[model samples]
Target: MKNLLILSLLYITLQANAQGLNERVIKLTDQLDSIGVATFEANYSHGLRTEYIVTVSCELYDDSPAPIKYQDQQGNILSVTPEQDKRIRDLWRRSHESYDLIRSTSRLLAEEGTECYIWESHRNGIDSLLYSVALRDFTNQQDKTYMPDLSTNPEWSKYGGAKEGFILKANPSRFLPNNDMEAYKKNRFQPKSEISFTYRLTVEEEDEDTVYYVDYKEFAGMIDKVLQTDGVKSHPILITHDKGAKVEDFKSEIISCDITHPDLDGETHGTVYEIETAELANTLRRLLSAEIGNYVDRHRNLNYLYRPLQDYSGDMRGMFSSNNWVIRTEFHTKHWYTFDKNLSCRVLLHHVGSKAYVLVLESVNDFWLPKDWHKLKSWKNGVKEYLYLQL
Candidate 1:
């Protein structure tokens, strides 16, 4: 009777845990939907205009310590590192600044131009826009900005993996009209948006964050400071979290998931399923493997960056493949996946298990293959069949 009762209890507990995880999965999905995504096109709202406009928001604080030094130095002032100077200036703007600033230097941009939006830090986790200015040439005497007015896809329209690109200074892209070539050639620039920004940011003085209201001159300075400083800028003002997603649900043994694929890119977004149980984590890995195996079969065009991902230089997809193992939060191994052996666009399943975090990096087309290769063939020789999804 005791054993039977214990077994019954275990069954009931497992059922309840599953029910909770399902709820958490739903909440994660809701959070993604609520936080939303930002997308913009040249024809979209306020992307371009004939008028010169500038907007600013600076709130005066009634409480907190009176404004102190924007840059606090102890020993020799010259000894202060650039990073330290930035921290001091940033804190002052958040805590001390009283005035508001706004300016519109737009003149020749009426036809086509780039606009820069300035955002400033605020108190209690609040950040407000310092101002926005339009540039006629996307370049002025001091700085150069990339204009999207003439381009089909501008910075404003970027979402997901699309945001991390480079702003290359080159001749007009193929998207530009042949007639406009002469004009575009006179002043040439291109954009390469990318995934990672300067990783040099330090959060040492994060506690000093406060709100700043700005004046036109101060607003201009704020813009210049962000452009010049490496790690001074905070998160974008427009990005905000609506409600918190409960983490408890995903940590349960039920293998809750909150994953999304923007589809425009070959990557997945927001995998926040937290697993505490080792057994549960293993099960989740199997589930992920199965799902990914299915995904690869359907999406044969997928590519991996490097082949023989492990140094062994052999078939890595095999289970017993000798990839180096390291101990961390959990047992982990990374393998590269691709349609063919060519290195272009590929997905890397990093690599995770207990506290597992799966990362799907960018993919590229197999450019090395012969041009006459058939798309539907199992292999180049039409002999062996592709078994990617069967895994």
Candidate 2:
């Protein structure tokens, strides 16, 4: 009974924490919407003749700090006293803040001619909570000086990533055509634009980042309340062994999953289920999608540039041993030309003699694979299948 009571209390605390996170997200969204409106007005006041679009992408990373430990110059580790530990925890909790504004851009896509303009700006050196309040004050109090009108800056949006304000006017625009500007203008403030928000909680013991919440349509509505322009999706994508494939065509493909296990007879293949109806298939798809999205976003945001994979050769037999369940998935794109566009991803579910299982996922698709793949599991020497989910 005592254990049950403790478990119930723990569950309640977790629920409360989740609720608090949602509240924070809502408050931040509201603050961002206000800033976005002010920014749009600020840009328009400076003669933006074409349709204006604002793309505001914000991310909050909440890291739960580990217990503090002291290390001396002699390389000896020491533990803090109870009182010291409490004080340290309090300080860490107070100092650590979440909510980072990734990038906020207000753009003007040319309506007819080959001209485009953009005002990209971001609040620096402030956490989301403080920035939200401070920016509100700045926008309301400063009025004309809320944000610089960089539309005249000669830099011309050359600085990659939206960290500062700059007006980029291009002749014969090389990017996406402004043909849809009218449609976007019509749909502006409609909240029908595509937007995605993902929340990931990394539990210390799991050592894996798990996406706790993901919403698209609803959050877009919240943002559209202020921007009043067709929304833009902020997720990042890499060419990754391009294979001369288009993103639109690649996303429609499905994954073929096969799990193989050893039986007394010899070897038994796990039953494959229909992806649309099977719970396991759905879970795998969701996990893969979230992982890929997060991975691409992290690399893109950090400006880590790398060449696409040209070729790779490695053996993958040892990781798919008889003792563990080997999960093999093949991603197939629509048949084009004589070559087959197929990629394989293999996962190992190691059984620790009971219900405890360790999962290791790998792929030759270098874009999908992490540099620290070995850190995910102990048995790290074997070649693993590559799994990349475009969706």
Candidate 3:
């Protein structure tokens, strides 16, 4: 009697929430008498003739989340015994298995290729009978668990990227290496073959299909305009790991590519911009001078300042080379670029193929150049080796 009353109360609660939806959807609920759960949606159209459509769904399987507990005579809560725990675990697993079986049942029905029974309903009640269930194009739709298609432009399929998902243009073209994330982080400056602007498709959720790229023309314009500067030789090529999928479940077009330079080793020569003008030389001189002056000013009072040029010691280290018109720098790395950190410069003018003076600051803890110290050591060394005028 006590157990019967408890079951009766549970039935009332289930009926209020689901109204026999579980029994209607599943044919073999006899074994699931204790813990089955279900939900449903219904539609009704009424006039002299009535029409209705009903869709039912079952809850996902879960491990036993709330096991039965008891209140002791002293009012403290107590856990179930070992035997009861075992039974609860079994019951929970059964519910989970049942839910999974129901989900796969639709796939099984498709394979069977025929309907055992077909029923339709009207406003009054289920009355009309229909035959045949059309199979969805699972290959094209990919996954139907989530909603798809919120595209504003119908012609988005012609361009690269998705047609209905999220896509953003990286202004400076930052590529995240998706093929191997670890390797990418370690050697991210690998040279890229393609020099064109890239538009990457991004996914917000797993089920979202067809990501689209807007403002493709606008972004293209930004990348090309930078090259119009005088004596601008080249721009940095980008290569990254990207998880962005394209709209080519059918056919995809490669929108961007770089023409490889046969002689250039991309790893050491990975720079974002290239300047070939005399202005490039001038700018390097001014920047170095300013930074060196700041460093000497800061550490002039230090007792053990190892002035390389003993005669030009004190606050005149940076000043000695400021008057010179020529400055030498590494051909490959002078143009190299990284995301944020400073580039390593080498003292070499052989690649420049012209009269040039190089700067190499071997060690300057006493100076404040950050990493701006060029490779040229002293002005005197410029007169000795690779000298092209000490100024």
Each candidate's lDDT (Cα)?
Answer: 0.24, 0.26, 0.27
**Mind giving the per-residue lDDT tens digits that candidate 1 earns over 179-261?**
25344333222111111111000101122222111122332232233223222211211101112322242234212122121
Enumerate clash totals for all models, in the order shown. Answer: 31, 4, 20
lDDT, candidate 3, at 246: 26
Error of 3 at 119 (Å): 27
Best by lDDT: 3
Which sections of candidate 1 miss by over 4 Å?
Answer: 1-147, 156-342, 348-378, 381-391
Residue 329 shift from truth in candidate 1, angstroms: 24
Q: Write the per-residue lDDT of candidate 3 for residues 1-391, one digit (tens) a residue.
A: 2333344324322432342232222442332333443222111111111111222222221243554445565758767788887775665565455544443443353344221112223322111222222222112233333222324322112221221111111111134343343443333232111111111111111332221211223322333343335554433222221222221311322222121222232211212233354444344333333332233223222111111111122222242333221111111112222122121221111112222233232111111111111221221201222112445
Clashing pairs in 2: 362-385, 363-385, 363-386, 364-386
Whole-model alpha-carbon lDDT for candidate 3: 0.27
TM-score of every candidate: 0.17, 0.20, 0.18
* C-alpha RMSD of each candidate structure in angstroms: 28.4, 25.8, 30.3
